[model samples]
Target: MEAPALEVVGLGKSFGSVRAVDDLSFRVEPGRVTGFLGPNGSGKTTTLRMLLGLVRPSDGRALVGGHAYAEHPVPGALVGAALEATGFHPGRTGAAHLAAYAPQVGVGRERCREVLEQVGLTAAADRKVGGYSLGMRQHLGLATALLADPPALVLDEPANGLDPEGIVWLRGFLRHLAAQGRTVLVSSHVLGEVQHTVDDVVVIARGSLVHASSLSELAATAGARTYVETPTPERLAELCAERGWTCAPTGAGHEVPDVPAAEVGAAAYAAGLELHQLATRGADLEDVFLRLTGAAA
Candidate 1:
């Protein structure tokens, strides 16, 4: 198997008396979208900053292409990162901003145009960044990251402030990049957006790694229980109790644990109970995330 495009080992960071990240470790493989997810102040941004060499880690290491980012001969060629979309000069045009980084990263003017087009920003390439909308700035930031044609990408909240159309475009764009044998690590607080986009996920909370696994595996690990919605929910609960199944009341329904959908249907029918809805509840990524992070859903 190929080596991971990016590897974080026992990474940690502290600010004053507070620990921002605690022994966080994960790997981003090529040709896959790895989601770096956490709630507010969960150290997701701090961790990405350390990986891109923007912030010095208090302990441990973040490696890109098997070497520390600072030690890489051509860091820009190996990794592309966008920590903040608006962290550019207000006076400079979008094209000018990219031109400045191009020479430093050994990327040519033609490559800049290609990336601008790739990110759907070629039409506004000459506009001053200060006048651009939030969505446009995000596109410009993405264009800048791709200027070097790097094999791996580290983006922090790339979809922030984007409209629904822009968000949809970004989803397809990131998937395309990953499909081309590149590793894409995206950090986002929007769990619903990343749930369908990422192949693997790393969830953190309170400066600690909570869970890391493939999307399907994480969902399965959360368990495969069935939810039964019935007009007579109390009767269903009684049936579950008689069968030694764990059942909890949720709103008008009963969340039956360790029971299959077929069994729930059979039980309801045998008990002469009328079920409004009976279906197997597939555990979503958000459910698993909240459970692991000890957060309310």
Candidate 2:
């Protein structure tokens, strides 16, 4: 099989006594959106920097399009990254910034215009970046990345400061890009937003990968179970306890562990108790994320 569009194998990095990334290994396939998720201080930014060749990996390697990004025949055309949109010169206009990078990467000015339009910044292309809001800066940054029409994209918190409309636009844009047979890796802390956008997810915690799988597989792994509610929570808890089941009391009910809905119904009927509510709670991406990352809600 052909090599993945982006692959990081046993990649490691450190600063002083801090191990920023530890033996990270993953592959981002072509024509898919892979969500890179982690809590704050989880080394995601560090890993993206290493992949883009801004920071050297202390050990192992990061490969883009079957080669190290620095060694690609046309690095900018092979991989485009938007780690920090606001890092550009404030004095330059959006169009100017993209034009400056175009030639260095052998891209033409027409390509720059096309990308600016693609990112919905054509109207404001001449506005100084300093006057741009965080959302506008993000669009400009994306425009720059698309100037080369690269086969892969690496984005860090690309939706950080976007409004609801901008967020919707970004999601559609990413899906469109992936449909064009490009690999898209987006890092975000907004699990709910990304859960509906990405095809797969790689979760990191404490600089280590805790989970990696397709969204459907993740949901299956963290499957839906029944939650029982009753006025007599204490009695329900006692019944569950005698049956070797775990139960936690809520305001007016007990969250029984891993029991079937029908079984719960039968149990309540046998006990001659009125069941106020019993429903199956579907496992969501956010729940899986929290469980894997050990993060508090």
How many pairs of residues collide in each model? 0, 0
Candidate 2 per-residue lDDT, tens place, 8-126, comes to: 99999999889989999998898999999998888899988888899999998988876788887778877778888768899998889999999868988888889989988889988
lDDT, candidate 1, 1-297, per-residue tens? 232388889999999889999899988889999998888789999998888898899999988877788888878877888888769898998888899999878988888888888888889889898988988888888888888888888888999988988888888988998988899999987677778789999899977888888888887877667888887767877888889999888776788866789988897888898988887887655776777777622
Best by TM-score: 1
| Pairs clashing within candidate 2 | none
Residue-pair clashes, model 1 = 0
Regions of candidate 1 where Cα sits further than 4 Å from its true position: 1-4, 240-258, 295-297
- Against the true structure, what is each candidate's TM-score? 0.90, 0.89
Among these predictions, the greatest lDDT belongs to 1
For each candidate in the order shown, give its overall lDDT on alpha carbons. 0.84, 0.84
lDDT of 2 at 269: 91
| Candidate 1 positional error at 127, Å | 1.7
